[model samples]
Target: MLVALREWSYSRILLVAAFLSIAGCAAQLAPPYDKTVADGLNSANTEAMTLMAATSQGTDKNSFSAREDTYNALIGTLDALALSAGARPMPKNRFTDAINKVLEKRGGKPIDDDDSTPPSAHSIKKIAETLTKMRDTDKKQGVTAIEAQAFKGQLVIYFDQAITYENFLQR
Candidate 1:
């Protein structure tokens, strides 16, 4: 009976240790407070407005191709920004140090950041998805003017949030 009790205690200790170790490995991103990032969003929003206007008048669908490159560049820039913002500081505990040592010895990867994934569970994902759908060439994928305007509204809201977040981080 004593032997069984000791084994159970050891198992519980190991389980708790494992959970804490796993929780510390997710440092995936960096600081996102930048004026240039806002400028990029503004540029993307302008392109979206132009597309919305053209789509509303039921004219110049082909003209969208002219602005496509600009929109894509902005999206790329935003994605890069989001990637940086997602980064977290490395965990500085003994467990993390030991794990890093082992991985280094075995020539294994230390960490990974999924670019497709947002740096946060914040509004960025919704913003990116809306932007992507706005540029979809397929008629079925095309967003209506009303939808575009709504998305622009979202942009404004998120921009406001970004400003607030920037101020918060600076303090």
Candidate 2:
């Protein structure tokens, strides 16, 4: 009886150790950036801008619900992306500061908690060049290889969106 009990305990311990080892080795095989997030934000921004236009005029009851759903999706995607980046991707840099300024000027409030001075045109140009480089992937050179390439399109889209807002403010 004693020998049987010991053997059972050993088997249980071995099974648990194997499970833990396999769990530790498990990794995500998918791309780092989610395509769903990109699509969600794109649709959400379009819906939001349309909704804003509608509000300025008369509210469209038919579109209201759809717009609300898009807004929710956008918010959820933003939260998920932030969480995924471990809250380190976004910072008060020149490009981001410019984006915040544009948002504030258009929306009458800052979207982020940026306390630094707004970035200069020179800084913005430099950052834009960097972003352009990032977006342009050269497979032969292995530029932005692997999971990072998945983010290029989304990053470009957001950059364009911010530029549009800034231009709107200019107008």
User: Any runs in candidate 2 off by more than 4 Å, and if so which?
Assistant: 1-37, 58-74, 81-171
Clashes of each: 6, 0
The per-model lDDT (C-alpha) reads 0.56, 0.43
- Model 2 C-alpha RMSD vs. true structure (Å) is 20.3
Q: State model 2's lDDT.
A: 0.43
Candidate 1 residues 54-103, lDDT tens each? 55533234566665775576567556655444443333556655775787
Please, what is the TM-score per model? 0.47, 0.24
Q: Please state every model's RMSD to the true fold in angstroms.
A: 11.9, 20.3
lDDT of 1 at 129: 59
| lDDT tens readout by residue for model 2, 1-171 | 999999999999999999997764544321234344345445544643443343333333444454455445544544453343232232444555566577789997656643432222222233234333332322223232332333334444554653343333232
**lDDT for position 91 in model 2:** 40
Question: Which residue pairs clash in candidate 2?
Answer: none
